[model samples]
Target chain A: MTASPDQIVVRDALKTYGTGAAEVTALAHVDLTVDRGQFVSIIGPSGCGKSTLLRLVAGLETADSGDVTVFGADPDQACAAKMIGFVPQVPALLPWLSVEGNVTLPSKVNRRADALRRTLPGHVHREPADPRALLTKIGLGDSLARLPHQLSGGMQQRVAIARAFAIQADVLLMDEPFSALDEFTREAIQVQLLELWEQMRTTVVFVTHSVSEAVVLSDKVVVMSARPGRIDAVIDIDLPRPRRQGLLESAAVHDYEDLIRGRLQTAWAAGPATR
Target chain B: MTDTTDTDQTGAAPTGATPTGAAVADTALATAATAAAASVRRRQPSRSLLRPTIWLPAVGALIVAGVLWEIVAINNTYLLPRLGMIGQAIVTQPSFYLENAGVTLSEALVGLVIGFVAAVLVAVLVTESGILRRAIMPLAVVLNVTPVVAIAPALVVAFGFGPAPKLIVTALITFFPILMNVITGLNSVSPPILQVFATLRASRFEVLTRLRLPSSLTFVFAALKVVFPLSIVGAVVAEFSAPGAAKGLGTVISVASSNSRLAVVYAAILCLAIMGSVLLFLVTLLEKRVLRWHESQRLLRG
Candidate 1:
């Protein structure tokens, strides 16, 4: 059963802070929808409620007014049903476990270790490959037995991403999982993530401030505005899949990049006057 | 780098404080006057195997002090005795002092164990509830403030001259620091660490086990170091206050003091010293075994 049109629907979703004097509108009267299997990126500057939006989709927080649904079910219900996987920016692996153990934890947690076993590729199955193969896709194979400290910054975040995928969830919600990495590592991970997305065809709602990253990764970039963060534009990137570092040099990616930068600057300019 | 040249020429790191410590001063003078010297390699952190060096010097210093006292009191056997005389008393009266030492050590150990268990449980409770902390913190203040000397008499009168009073007194004496340190340790999970756990939706127990407990081990062991001597002091005070008590090291010392058996008194004192050192040693060893991944313990590894 592949994805259809009305996959994740948000209707009149409101998240307001305190009332009257203490009032703050975090996500005000937002309404948008991403089709099933759509790779969407919600890109905006800091405090544009990008994180608040992702948290809503992940079912980590509730909407104050309206609805958020995943695969025709409520976000929270669908999440509990193991329909979503989240990779927070921080490396959230339990420090006590090895990398392989951390990657396999989500499976073990759900009484679904057999899923990881079945998902193992033939070349991986023959040689007793580590579950680290998933992590290795993100370039952390050398650290199977290593703890979090032993690995560098980019490597630990790779483990966190692998752990998310191992659970075999349909949706991947990432919150700028590579902002902390160096430029070289960040680009490398972005390319590798594209490869995983092409193969899995899973929907992703990536939250990021980097316009270039959003342009490179998403099929649709849903640009957000300031304060009571509402959608400004939903720019589509119809570029081909398995795109390379060379693709970043292409006119298509740059065209989308300029378009998002223009929209974000306008949002930023209007932001201060309202205050 | 040339940034290290001054330190390299001096062959010693400068003092961390405003003034130089003896270790640094000794290094500079000793180095400047000499050459072909081996570098001071930050003292390759002493392992459990190497830790005995710390005790050896202290014991040696004690022995030297005892010898000097014996030399001064060669004729006056009442106030002080010869080092040889104390050694003879310990060896010849093996059944006499050893039994008493054993009795005192056992009571101290039992008190420490009971006190430790009670302290940990209360610490966990206090950490969980502000109400419980408010209720118990005052009680802990009372326990800490009430000296063993004053309370030992009442404990002895209640539990009598047996090991019961001695164990109870010691337990009360050793409980406060252990409880306070443990409570602080249990609640010491940095907010960031807890947030990581919570965002992962890790269970509260998992958070406690992996994060909180690992952090608490160091503090708990520090409390153990403080409480070890307290255990012995408690046992001794309990016995000393109840002079009617027999079969304790304190009883041996009290009797020896009255009869002017100076060698026996010195022998009992030696036993107490040995007991304190051994208990502290065991706790340190346990800390190393349990927390090999700890930063302090990892530094100690090399």
Candidate 2:
């Protein structure tokens, strides 16, 4: 069978914060691509610019140079088209809005995005999931009227996840969505996320610090180094589907973990790359 | 609620694993219902001021203060009027004090409404444009620092013995705090949420209505609590300073004190105190109702 089309593409993308003596490169000449329906995780140590890369893809920040595209359009165009979904590290749910209100917020906004999409010749179109149904699938069905603070951290992130999915965007960019959660909660939410992703088949670019988390949730794990945040290696997980709790202890998963860990160590030791 | 929750769960249950899934969902729902019931019970007590936790000590302290004032006034009759004498004076001509209070209260209310609207409009403009913020904020600060009470005679001289000067003074006194607080509240949104709105491509209007304005309610209420009582003070001060002003609580105090009617003077001051407290209380009640979802209100309840 022919391969799926490229849904996201980033070429030589560079991003920096501050200026002069305080200048710090967040993403340096970052090049990456995510195919349609693929689950890719950008895994690295802290300060590795994975979140910056996600932000760039989400069109929340601009790259200093190079190209970033979603569905062959600029990130801003994709954002305006409502083709990009983002889940921040913190849930970032609007405090005043109830869970249902928060989940359904995207529906109330970006009507112009649809009109813009209609102007395009070839555009990705998918059915937006009902917010209530998505909430139920994520085990927060009864909390529709509850405020964001009324819910636990895990539950709030679940709402965030549901909200991101409710938009039915072409690509989902998550920045450490589960890193704040406890291990059990994270794993459980990971399974719930995978179940949702399996049904929607939306291209996902997730950022995380966990090795096994990156392996289990993503088809391809991108390992990045710090100081000058750039891709160190990209490892393909050939493991079978339904990668549940039991898969974490499996020998093949451990092998992939070891390989990623070893590369991460070398990346950690590399320090700032000399010109 | 439980029935609705059960129906939702049953409807969501898959086709094949009906028995076990239904049992699990039932158990989960039962636990959730218990927790919800417990939370509801915990939050059941109304926050009305009549509640013993608030009013019991309030009444007790008020009685003790009244007795202490009576004792002090017995020794120093020249300065402090006895509580009973003040009460007698008020009862002797209740309509006189009431009419003057009515005039003062009307001035304060009208000025307060004008001030709030003007402050909110200017706040929106200030937040929308940096140039406006720079131009308007300093002028507001200048107005705030230049004692509005000191300007009452000038307003009276210019405007000619009318209510316009008193209303203008009250509005000026009440404007700055609300403007400052509103500016703070509008800018109080966290960066990540702003980013989320940006990603959603929400229009400026949507961002203002759905995000900025809702978040600013707490700050607005806080400013209102201070400025509501200050509005009354402003109107009274204007009446005291404006030479031609003949009918207000402040004028009653000025005339009675000059005539050595200490009881009447104390009575007018007492009326002003009660009016100020009532305005503050009304503001608080409105705050509680509007900010039920806010963290500050939740913390107060517990």
Candidate 3:
């Protein structure tokens, strides 16, 4: 194992969509590095390219001009190796699959497609720790037999969370996962998220519009500007967990929230394309 | 279910329920009017418990019609052919009707399988590649637009008057809905759900196998429910065109028509209806079994 404290490094990243007259620059010279085990949440308005940034790191999209290295390796290459685990906004569990099958999905997707493929089944598509144990870790032990449709929205997302952990990836990326959920479910999942993070400390880069969510779940919140999305400010959250909504009741949390919203509001108002 | 309806009622209250309830009420009214009309003509299945009641009246009507036919045809044996005469023919020539029915059913089953498989392959290929989608979609539409009647003779000539022509017809007719619905289902992956897969470092194969295929299953099966019967119809019609030469009820019906075996034709027609119903029923069974996880199935199960 490489002894490295920094897992992600993005240098002068540029992302442009379309070409010529129709060309729109989504990201411009975005330079970011996330340290190992750091819980970073990128907060911004819609169209702020926070999702684009995460996608850039996840290898879901390519940067026109930049290098992104995760775990001291190329992000896409590491992802292909099953080095990064992603938990998206809506739980995209296979509907035909039961909860157990959904969680085991990543494991079934072969990591080594060439050379060792025939012999790669055991390590690549693992039936490691019983699904029960993995589900228990994410507060979803009882849902293994249920399908996604049978579960509530929050429950479904939790299963998504369980699947990500089940993959045993070293890094995790979540993008506005709780935005559509109700307040109670969001908070409950947030608490569960912290517990999961504590157990695995996988370098995480979460994107969210909710300032309070960023303040509650993140170690550092990267507030961003609109349109040509860029990091406006980075606020460190030192609140201790097992976290509760009471943390937000504190003046410090509100101050952070206030700071983020103030930055976002100013950024939002100054944009040609409303964020 | 009650809780959900209550929640919806309270949340949306006036507008949403009004429109939805109006639609439901309109459907209910139409069904009621249809049942009433059927009942006036005969007896209808009015009670939910009387599902048998619905068919009973229709059978009674058929029997009444048959008696009238027997009365009318008692004098001229050429037209209706006495009911007793037909019954005698059915009893004595059980093999004739049974054999033709079996042949037709088998042809339908083969065509259904071929069509289903072809549709699924087309759906998967088109979903995966945009160029393939652009290329293959128009071909599918052109096939759909080509009338079965117009193509039946060509198919018979090209494939010979064997099961090949009939199977081709069925496969052609049944391929559209399954392909269309499955494509829609596969592409229906919500952005949020896709984001979850991305975060997990889930491979393309993982996303496709786990998310795309499974999610599209309900849509696929829904298409099958419609297409299976169409396949049966397509196959039978093609066989009818090929008459006496092809192994199907359609051949029997055509031969019977020329021979003036009117009772035999009716028997063949009944068998055709049964075959269509059975194929549709089989698809329904598969849907219920496979998509027990789908929301529609969950609501039904609940």
Candidate 4:
């Protein structure tokens, strides 16, 4: 209840779909708190409500019960204040727009939202980053005028990452953003993403099913179980900073990855029958 | 390595003037070659236009069809005129066909403009409101299923004679395709993109204008390909129903056939075909320009 202006707090948030005989619970009693500028990952088996948690925090879906707050305000208010940026699993660049156009769209739209927010008393507004410079930093300078279909899968995902960074949001929620890329491209983008995050210092809540991915990018990984989805455990990643491809071969990184994998296996085994 | 050493020894021999002069000659030759290649590249597209494979088959087919038509007309003169006679009629009364064809083209174009705007407006409304979509979609389906030819007479009665009925008929024929296409395009946005817009806190109007509208352009153009021909057919049908004092291509066809001027009738039919082709070509050009960034257009260029 004492969540600060820079933190995201979720208190026993629940979400359900359908009704009566067909009713299904997606999330149950999910309580999590992501502090300011912390990179958190949610990892679980399929249909374990990992993405549902991100959606709740994004204000895209309302929790059936309990509360979710961002920066001491409702998720809706936080979203309206242009503090949340989301990247879906698919690289959802507009097909009609060039790479630069897609990257700049959020910034342009946020300007209008910012203007509306300023009409209200005591609203703080932050200027978004330059999209061209951001795209160049993300290594997409050569593809500014290329359409979405012209780019490879990995390139498109990088564009999506650059787009999320371009918005200059206080918090970013990504849903398995690199899931579609090959292993090599995924690692490259991970490094690029880490560099961007390090520079911006924005809070991130990334949802993924890959243990190595969660371990590599997140400060803490929240593991959840399905069949009435709920969080089972939280694992803190103690690996050193500036995590790079070299760290992937390190014994310490392997140990952390193995620990999370073991917990995920246990969580998967502890199903509805055990509950 | 050996080549560099050889060049170095040669330069060290105090005959640098000879090597330097040779290098200058080589640079000039390279520039001349590059310019020649550039000119060839510049001429490539126009050369492709004149290639035998591109135009020969089409021209051959047209000649064969013309010969067949002439032969058939010699045996059945009353039913089908000779190709030469139709050409003579077109050459003799060019102004008559031109004026009537212009009237039909104008009607179709006006109706298309009105129907396109109305379809876009209705599509926007349906996309924004679930209630309107539910109520209006079924009615649109019913209208689409009803034949325009069957409605032409009723339209003539409702709007009376003159161009009003023709315009309505053309609008009616075109409205449904545009509506269906616009709705499909507006709704075809990927859910992930919608989620991105939602996260950005884009206003409903912004979502419609920025995302939905641009996404719908390809579909709109696709629908236009069908609408172009359909609009002309509608105008001709409407003219048939009510061809007052204002003569259109449909009136020309009816009048010529009644007077047994089969050549003039064929000439009018040719004019209609040409009009349809021209409109389709214009729509395609517009589509290429507007959808240059789309994958379909990109694939087409390749």
Per-model B-chain TM-score: 0.79, 0.84, 0.74, 0.84
Worst 10 residues of 2 chain A by lDDT: A1-10
* Model 4: lDDT of residue A39: 96
Candidate 4 error regions (>4 Å) = A1-3, A110-112, A115-127, A273-275, B1-51
Q: Write the per-residue lDDT of candidate 3 for residues B58-155, one digit (tens) a residue.
A: 78998999778778988887876676766777788888788877877777778878888888888989988999989999989998888887898888
The positional error of residue B213 in candidate 2, measured at the CA in angstroms, is 0.5
List model 1 lDDT by residue over B228-294, tens digit each: 9889999898889889987899988998899987788989998899889998999998987776545
TM-score, ranked from best to worst:
2, 4, 3, 1
Residue A36 alpha-carbon offset, candidate 4, angstroms:
0.7
User: Can you rank all candidates by DockQ, best first?
Assistant: 2, 4, 3, 1
lDDT per residue for candidate 4 within A1-275, as digits (tens), equals: 56466568999998998899787789988999998889999999988999999999999999999999887778887778777889999989898888999988887774666655555332445666988888878877766886765555667787888888887777899999988666666777788899889888889999998888899998999999897899999989988887877887888878988888888888888876432
Per-model TM-score versus the true fold = 0.76, 0.90, 0.80, 0.89
| Off by more than 4 A, model 3 | A1-5, A18-23, A113-130, A241-248, A269-275, B1-89, B129-139, B154-161, B185-208
In candidate 1, list every pair of residues with a backbone clash: none
List RMSD in Å for every model shown: 9.0, 6.9, 8.6, 10.3
Instruction: Compose the digit string of candidate 2's lDDT tens values, residues B1-302.
Output: 34334433433333112212222324355335435543543444443344575567889999999999999999999999998899999999899999999999999999988998999999989998999989988888889899887898888888866799889989998999999999899988888788887888988888888888889999999999999999999899889887567899988888889999999999999999999999998989999888877878754543
Best by TM-score: 2
What TM-score number comes out for model 4? 0.89
Model 4's alpha-carbon lDDT is 0.82
lDDT at A33, model 3: 73
Expressed as tens digits, the lDDT of each residue in A80-178 for candidate 1 is 445567888776555556778778765544333233334422101222224666776666665577555334455667777777676566678888888
TM-score of chain A of each: 0.88, 0.94, 0.89, 0.93
lDDT of 4 by residue, B1-302 (tens): 34334433432332222222222213334234324433443444465558676678889999999899889999999999998888999999899999999999999999988889989999999989999999988998999899999999898888887888888889989999999999999998999999988988888988999999999999999999999999999999998888563689998988778889899999999999999999999999999889977867643443
lDDT of 3: 0.73
